[model samples]
Target: MSEMVIETSNLTRRYGKKISVNNLNLHVPKGSIFGFLGPNGAGKTTTIRMLLGLIRPTSGQIRIFNQTLPKHRMQILRRTGSLVESPSYYGHLSGYENLDVIARLLKVPSKRIDEVLGIVRLTSAAKQSVKGYSLGMKQRLGIAAALLGNPDLLILDEPTNGLDPAGIHEIRALIKELPAQYGITVVVSSHLLGEIDQMATHVGIIERGHLLFQDAIEKLREQNSPKLLLQVDKPLEAKRLLQRAGLQVSMDGDILQMPNQGLAATEDVNRRLIQAGISVYRITEQSRSLEDIFLDFVDKEGSL
Candidate 1:
């Protein structure tokens, strides 16, 4: 089993009467891409700030790489790299020069610049002026700067914020490759479920200053109760047949729906419907997407 790289116990942060983060207990496994998912104003940035010790938590604890925060801040930070929100770059300077300045500040070897540039696929545009780079290039450059520290853990807050579809795809691909290629544990935050669905190994969902869910991506999928939809000529009769077979069923227009019990159950439903003299036109199992699950969680929370 992998070690816990990030763990928070009742991590809370409040601003006067407004609570930004409410007892968020997050667990991130080592060598995994942990996607911090939430809607806007969900306190993702606030939690990240606390993790970096930029702001003190109201009351709670944070452990990174098995080291407690604030107390061992410098020791923890030395092994972590982060790119928060918009990246800062000297537009007047070339990409290479900008990285050179950062390297000098960190006192890292100058030769490491080229390696990072290649890692972010910015080596070809190393000499290009930052002012002329595209938004995607700038974001990649920000990631490159983060990599300059050669840290074991990388924290990125909305790394693909304002980019076209193609640009988002590029950044996602790069983030997915980091853990495998460099052995870095990544903690990336994003508001879009679809964005993280493609690359994240584990996901933590926060809403209204509260963490609604946290687990492996596959485990979340298992939590989704698959439903089978049946379109039949006799909806009422089909529903009756399914219910009589000890299956809970519902209906929507001409469609008969029931809990998906797997392939055998689905086949049994079809056969049973036919045996009852009901004509089954279509039997489709609808699986919930991550977006669907996210919205449901948020909506449910809002109601409570």
Candidate 2:
């Protein structure tokens, strides 16, 4: 089993009279890209700020790298790099100079500055003033600064906020390479579900400050309940044949959901439908998506 890089036990945070984060328990394993997903105003930023010790939690505990946060903040931060919301850069200075300043603040070696600039593919534009750089270039500069410490873990909040499709793809590829090539743990938050589905090894989904689910991406995909969607020429005959086979099948217009049964049994039902003068157009395994599952759970809990 991999080590637990981050753990929160009933983590809670509040602002004045409103509770911004409520009982968020997150476990992010070492060497995995954990996708932190939530709707806007869902307290994702609040949770991140707490993790970095930038803000104090009203209740609960947070542990990073096996050390309690806020108390050993300096210790934890030494091995962590983060980019939250927007990238900060000195417009008047060149990209190289911007990173040079951060390197000095972190007291990193002078050679390390060049290494990170190369890592984010910003070396070519390092001499250009940041004021004339594109949005993507500025974002890359922020990433360069984050890698300055060669931290074991990188926390990025909406890293692709203002990038074009090509820029987004470049960032995605870089993020995917971090864990495998450099042995770094990545915690990324994004509103794009499709991108998260493609990039994450594990996922933690939250809604309205409550943690809805946390598990491996593959495990979540496997948890989808099995159903069959079929298109047939003779919908009526197909329905009748399935019912006669002792299968509880229902038809909605032209589509049908095969009854819960073994895979072999389901195949047999399909064969019967075809043989009963029904021309089967298509047969597909139906599964609920992450978004679908998230909404269903939220609605179910809200009704209680």
Candidate 3:
């Protein structure tokens, strides 16, 4: 197992009688882009706040950088940087000036501000007032500010919310580069499955304050294995022939469906079917989509 930069055990939080976060365990491996995914009001923000020490967990333990939170809050924070929702910035301040304010607070050298500006590709707009900047530019500036501290971990909550396609692409590209270019571990939260699918190496899914899945993105994909699909003549005959020949096959209208055997096996099956006078029009593989898998988890867990 890789080193867990952020590990939680039975972490839970409540607001009055409503439980915002049920018992949860999250493992974020170092140097991995961890996608924190959940629906709105699913306790994603609450979990982030607890991880950042912005709010205390009702019960459970949080360990970041191998140090327990709150006890080492300042120390953990010093090596951690975060941007939750829209970044807080002075509109009147120039991009550089805004970063400088945060830099001063972190006691980071002035040159580090320039470095982060370059990292976020905001150096060209360094002197521009943030009020005049585009939404994407402001997001980049927020990321620059986060990078100013040169922290090992960066957590973002809905960082791409309310952005145009180009803007979203820009942020996604920048985030995808952080791990390899700067050795930064990122914990980015999003409700969009496609966004997480495109960027994250690992994923944690939550719904109604309950975490449904946590593992490498590939593992989630493995849950929905592809099935062989075929459109052929006399589907009933094809199904009967394949099944008798030791291949499990079913019919969906005029098409035949079965588990996707390997290329050679499929080829052998195809040859046998052709010999049996069943014309094969089209052969393809179909699998349940991630959205399908996600919905399955939500539905099944909700009922439980």
Better of 1 and 3 by TM-score: 1
Give Cα-based local distance difference scores for all models. 0.93, 0.87, 0.93
Per-residue lDDT value at 134 in model 2:
83
Give the per-residue lDDT of model 1 (tens digit) for 79-157: 9999999899999999999999999999999999999999999999999899999999999999999999999999999
TM-score of each: 0.97, 0.91, 0.96
Better-scoring candidate (lDDT), 2 or 3: 3
Model 2 lDDT tens row, 118-223: 8888889989999999888888889889999999999999888878988888788888989998889999997676778878999988777888779898877776
Off-target runs (Cα >4 Å) in candidate 1 are: none
lDDT of 3 at 261: 67
Candidate 1 backbone collisions, by pair? none
Q: Give one digit per residue, the lDDT tens place, for model 3 in 1-304.
A: 6999999999999889999999999999999999999888888999999999999999999999999988999999999999988898999999999999999988899999989999999988999999999999999999998888999999999999999999999999999999999999999999888899899999999998999999999999999877999988878888888889889888778878899868998898889889999899988989899878888888887899
Distance (Å) between predicted and true CA of 292, model 3? 2.9
Displacement of residue 193 (Cα, Å) in model 1 is 0.4
Error of 1 at 96 (Å): 0.5
